[model samples]
Target: MNSFLSTSTARDLSLIFSGQGQQRPQLESILFEITIETSTCETAFADIQYVSWMQGEEEILITIGAIVRIDS
Candidate 1:
């Protein structure tokens, strides 16, 4: 089944993290910088920033059902 991936238009959003909690330090973290280019008519995703409750997040709502691959 598909899922909703909450993403942001802000390039600087902290998507992942690494820190010390256990006796050993946590492993390094990675972030996938996804660049999405779509026509204005595309409906796979929607810009909900204005209506979003978390206005500061600059969120973009994506429908995973329409997503086939990361390379697209």
Candidate 2:
């Protein structure tokens, strides 16, 4: 069974669209570089920036039970 996970891009939009983000470890945080490969999986996300209450946050709504690959 696959679990649902919520992820979002921060201030830099490149994080989500271009897979560009910090690789260094933080004080108390685990960072996973996620890439949305359409060829491998179905579309399971929606751009909710326009409908979100806080539009400035630039939120991307991911569907529940979406499958993703995680690398360590």
Against the unseen true structure, what C-alpha lDDT does each candidate score? 0.63, 0.61
lDDT of 1 by residue, 1-72 (tens): 566767787755544222223344455554555566675435477789999998978888777765434653
- Candidate 2 yields a Cα-based lDDT of 0.61
lDDT of 2 by residue, 12-68 (tens): 653444344546554344456667775876857777778878776676666676766
Instruction: Estimate the TM-score for candidate 1.
Output: 0.58
After superposition, which runs of candidate 2 have C-alpha atoms over 4 Å from their true positions? 1-5, 11-28
* For model 2, the run of ten residues with the poorest summed lDDT: 13-22
Candidate 1 lDDT for residue 64? 70
Per-prediction TM-score to the true structure, in the order listed:
0.58, 0.53
